[model samples]
Target: MIRPDDETKPFVGRWNSLIRILLVESSVKHVARAAMDYANLYDGTSCHPSNERLARETGYNERTVRKAWAAMRGMGLAERVSHGVAHRRLSDEYQLVIPESWQSLPVLGPSGAKFTCVHCEKAFNPTGNCKVHPDGRVTFDLIPMVFCPEPRQRKGREEPWCATEWDGQRRASGETPWSQLGQERWKVFHLARGEEW
Candidate 1:
């Protein structure tokens, strides 16, 4: 008997904020999920999964898998690392590019007036000092932290509803986020949060 788990790889490591952001903006849920699954299997820079394998793992048809792959690549989430093997056709490797620095710009929402986070669900106004891009566009650095469904537990303190504390930490650590910790420790921290390996 071919069990469902047998067809799918264990999801490990922290999901990239960019992927979550894309999922919110994606019109097709299945395709977004497929993209996420592919990202979970990514090894540092790339992952190699045949269409058949992705279809089996994501429970989507091969055509859907191909569409999902193309969509993700088009959205700048996945990049083809290599072409198919010569003569014999083979799966192409893809690199997952997670956006680290996301700009916060003003966008009109259903409420008519609100400053929403360009990357995620969180909302914040673009005040204080802003960075001006080469195209004459301005952006803020008040991006929310990566999504963490569980509330943070602190001694004698009320837990916050969402994971937004990373912003301060990132600023304190200088321009590069997660630069304070070593790579190994960072992985461990992500694992503790239920992120994939």
Candidate 2:
């Protein structure tokens, strides 16, 4: 999780990855931006804003805002911490979360040890055409897409997902942007790879 006022490198990196890489829908991105503004001015962990306020801030209709909220929740970016009681006239509160899968990813692009392949022990680039093998041989036929041997799950954290070549192929083929395949499909993809979602 990141606070809206956080200025640290790690926080900023995670924020950049979320807003720039993970979020694909424009409306969802707009709502997320508005939520961040509210989060900075409001409480640190959560923000309470009515749908109308979000709509006004994003220049979107209430329905669009609602859909964006749902999409954000599905993306594991934000979740409602508290629901408003209509009779009491309270507003919903939401807390932004950094998905475990994104924690080890590079802020700008694939970098560091998180992208290293378990098979070749080589660091793979998410958007590249080739990679240097362990024998110091450059392979032009391979795209250097990589994944963890298995899902990395801590005691309480959500399962951390590493990218595979299929993800790169989808991006290369222009089928779907990574992380925008919707929640169910993303889960199925991981589960198919023997990761328990």
TM-score of each: 0.37, 0.47
Candidate with top TM-score is 2
* lDDT string, candidate 1, 1-197, tens digits: 11112324322232333333221223233544555565545343547767777777767788767666665564444678897783586878877644332211111222323333322445442222233345544332222222334456788987654334554555766744443444443232223222221
Predicted candidate 2 versus true structure: per-residue lDDT over 1-197, tens digit per residue: 34222546454345544565431456766887777766633333567888889998899999988777776666556768899886887778988766665522212232222344433344443332222344433222222233444456688886534455557667888877446755444333223222221
Report the alpha-carbon TM-score of model 2 versus the true structure.
0.47
lDDT of 1: 0.44
Worst 10 residues of 2 by lDDT: 104-113
CA lDDT of each prediction against the hidden true structure: 0.44, 0.54
Residue 178 error, candidate 2, Å: 15
> Which sections of candidate 2 miss by over 4 Å?
1-13, 40-44, 103-197
